[model samples]
Target: MDWGSIFSNAMASALGPDAIVYALAAIGLNVHFGYTGLLNFGQAGFMAVAAYGLAASVATWGLPFWVGIAIGFGAALLLALLLGVPTLRLRADYLAIATIASAEILRLVFGSVTLSDWFGGSNGRQQFANTFYDMNPYSSRLDFGLFSFSANDAWVFTVGWFLVALSCLAVWSLMRSPWGRVLKSIREDEDAVRSLGKNVFSYKMQALILGGMFGALAGFMLAIKQQSVIPTDYATDITFFAYTALLLGGAGRVLGPVIGAIIFWFLMTFLGGFFSSAASIDLIPDVVMSDIQASLVRFILVGAGLMALMIFRPQGIFGDRREIAIDGR
Candidate 1:
């Protein structure tokens, strides 16, 4: 097995665009599920709206890049409002069902034949990110012996990390304020917060909007990194993956999602590389596992690993046990 190549691939994936995208998405999930105790299972919906918002505005309507950015953010905000107003007052499970359903609905709508002209349907949209790439300063690939990134990827890497840093700072600062304390209180017990004459519904809505905005940022990064937007990209698994990252890192803490994202992708890529290499070298019998099966072994191992983590440390690496306790009332 090529251990050197395995390590290199792991390192690259740990710091790659995929990690950045999930980190941002997990951060947004932290705001909703961590700080505010929201059961938003449709985070991918928010991402989709923003991604297609940018893709349609630029690739279809011939708008400037900045306008697309505004539209994406606006769409996220609107989604938050639409989802929150109808479900926040209900039980937490209702919100979860609504969110997950809404996301799937949006995905299907975007991929529908009727909307192909505007959204490009299942084929998706491209040619919308030229303006974004035009500002790249890296001019050449950044090869650091073990791993490398193309000039365009290098640009996204820089901006993505910056956004991660900025998001963490904002979460840290907000969680220290009185408002942030209220959110924690709500997470612990909404009835107690309501007894204090605080408007619980309003706070929930604000958190939803804030978290949705973060999801939108992740969408923008994902869209610009690929310079395309496809409806299938915002599938239900995206939200689950973000949740997994959030849980692994320790939710309710400011930097938990960021660290979790790094570790999650690192382990996933490392295991995949190891299995692929082993299979290629005939270390395992073909009767036991094929090259195709080797690729999927990572998911099984990771799932089992996550199960172990939940059984042993449900709060995650950096999360407090009390933090995961949500107030269903």
Candidate 2:
């Protein structure tokens, strides 16, 4: 097996656009599940709407790129209001059910034949990100020792990392404020916070809107990086994966999502590269594992790793045990 190649690929993935995308999404999830205890399982829905918002605004309506961005953010804000108002007052589990269901519903609607004219149905939308790429400052590929990036990818990396940094700073600042303290207190016990004459519903809505905006940022990153917005790309698994990243990094902590995203992508890429290389060399018997099967082993291993983490260290690398204790009431 080519160990050097595998290691390089893993390194590249650790810092690539995929890591940035998940990091932003996980940061949003951390705000919801980690800090506020919101149980927002529809994060993918937020991302989808924002992505489609931008795609439709530019590709279908011939709007400017910046206008598309504003529309995407607006769409995310609308989604948060729509989801939070109806279910934030209910039990956390209800919020979870509502979010997950709504995410799936939105995905189906975006892909529906009836909406093809606007959303491109199952095919999705492209040709909407040229404006973003046209602003690239890097005229040539950026070559690092371990991996290299095309000029386009280099521009994305710069923008994506900047966004991640800005989001982290915002979360850090917010969590240290009085409002942030209340959110933590509410997470520990909403009834107690409510007894203090605080408007729990209002705070919850604010957190939802803030977190959904972060999700929208992630959506923008993805749409720009891929130069397309496909409904299928916003599946429920996307939200779960972001959750996994948040859990791995430790929820409620500002840097947890970012760290978790880097590690998650590193491990995933390393395992994938290792398996693919081994299979190419027939290190494992064909009957035991084919090239196709090699690609799947990484997910199985990661899943088992996640289960172990939940069992042995539910608080994650940087999370406190108390942070995971949600006040379901």
Q: For residues 1-329, write the lDDT of model 1, one tens digit per residue.
A: 78898999998888989999999999999999999999899999999999999999999999999999999999999999999998999988999999999999999999999989999989999979999899999999989789999999999999999999999999999999999999989988999999999999999999999999999999999999999898889999999989999999998989999999999999999999888778878887788898779978999998999999998888899977664464222
Q: What pairs collide in candidate 1?
A: none
The sequence of per-residue lDDT tens digits that candidate 2 reaches over residues 30-111 is 9999999999999999999999999999999999999999999999999999999999999899999999999999999999
Candidate 2 C-alpha error for residue 54, in Å: 0.3
Clashes per candidate, residues 3 or more apart or on different chains: 0, 0
For model 2, the run of ten residues with the poorest summed lDDT: 320-329
Q: List TM-scores for all candidates, in order.
A: 0.97, 0.97
- How much does each candidate deviate from the true structure in C-alpha RMSD? 2.0, 1.9
Relative to the true structure, candidate 1 has a C-alpha RMSD (angstroms) of: 2.0
Runs in model 1 with CA error above 4 Å? 321-329
| Ten-residue stretch with the least lDDT total in model 1 | 320-329
